[model samples]
Target chain A: AQSVAQPEDQVNVAEGNPLTVKCTYSVSGNPYLFWYVQYPNRGLQFLLKYITGDNLVKGSYGFEAEFNKSQTSFHLKKPSALVSDSALYFCAVRDMAGTGRRALTFGSGTRLQVQP
Target chain B: GAGVSQTPSNKVTEKGKYVELRCDPISGHTALYWYRQSLGQGPEFLIYFQGTGAADDSGLPNDRFFAVRPEGSVSTLKIQRTERGDSAVYLCASSPDPAPNEQFFGPGTRLTVL
Candidate 1:
């Protein structure tokens, strides 16, 4: 079984300030982690994924996430926040090595509010 | 060059009625997936289709929920006896192949049972 945990229900960041949204994952084998953003009345858009090789992965919309193997954490980061970035963010994980080629397990998501 | 697409952007139905949601995956993507999203929650895996066959249906909640992709390009999810609990946004996604499961999502159909 694989699971993901996003501790915060909401995160507030000011425009032009750096932002960080936390995520942690649990999996039996190796973990394939991903981040997505959802605007109002819209489907989720893939932001970034960490499969292998690099601990730090950059994604779309000027967003990036760091995969910390030791702590089992993959935190999404942005060098500077923008007002348009306000949306719901989700963290997902899957067991890439599992036999099932299982579906991604998503966290309860965190709403980000970027104040201008 | 189009992304995944789903039909019936919004469906309002009475309880006990049957409703169907449709999805058209991107051209050439071999793997398609169906997921359900409730208010204030992330999408929940419902089914997975590889080619023309249903690769996995473990996430389907009950027998009333059925999905098919006979032609391998389009899929339909049918719900029998619509209930208030079944009201949610049904999302469809597709991926290329093999290792990367990076699914491209459709706008989804919001189903409401009255």
Candidate 2:
């Protein structure tokens, strides 16, 4: 089974400071990891994904995530946080070696709170 | 081009009522998906359709939940009997292919079962 875990239910960071939202995964084979952000009453917006590429993957809205295979983690990061950056973050994983199933298994989600 | 769009941005219904949610995938998109998201939780996969066929419906919780993508374009999700547990944001997403690609999501229909 492919699954993702967001250890933190909520993360708070000051504006202009770097912020990190942690995510870990477990899959039977090579994993396709993704990050998505959802704002109030809106659908989830894709941030970035790591299928088979460099360790660090940059995404929308000045956000990025590091795919650390050894640590089984894909933590979302931002160089500088802004108040508008606050939203619900989700980490998802798909098993590349699975039975051709492309449905993503998502984590519980982490709320990112960027304080001004 | 416009992204995936779902109808009835919000729906409120009493228990035991039958409801239908519609989704219009991006033009030419071959794949469509349905998911349910509860309060404080991430979206949970419900079903996936490839073309006009249901490629994968294993994620559906029970027989009460059903979906269809006729003509390989627009899709509809039907719930037989509404329950309080079914209250959540029903999301619809679409991808260009069946491969493991990034999916574009719609604003979602907020279903409130009263």
Minimal lDDT window, size 10, model 1 chain A: A96-105
- Per residue, candidate 1 scores C-alpha lDDT tens digits across A1-116 of 78889999999999999999999998888899999999998888999999999899999989999999889999999999999999999999888774744677899999999999
Assign candidate 1 its CAPRI class: medium
Model 2 whole-model lDDT (C-alpha atoms): 0.94
| Candidate 2 lDDT by residue in tens digits, A23-45 | 99999989999999999988989
lDDT of 2 at B68: 91
TM-score of each: 0.97, 0.98
TM-score of 2: 0.98
* TM-score of model 1 (first chain only): 0.97
Error of 2 at A97 (Å): 1.2
- Interface alpha-carbon RMSD, every candidate: 1.3, 0.8
**What is the DockQ (computed on Cα atoms) for candidate 1?**
0.72
What is the alpha-carbon RMSD of candidate 2 to the true structure?
0.9
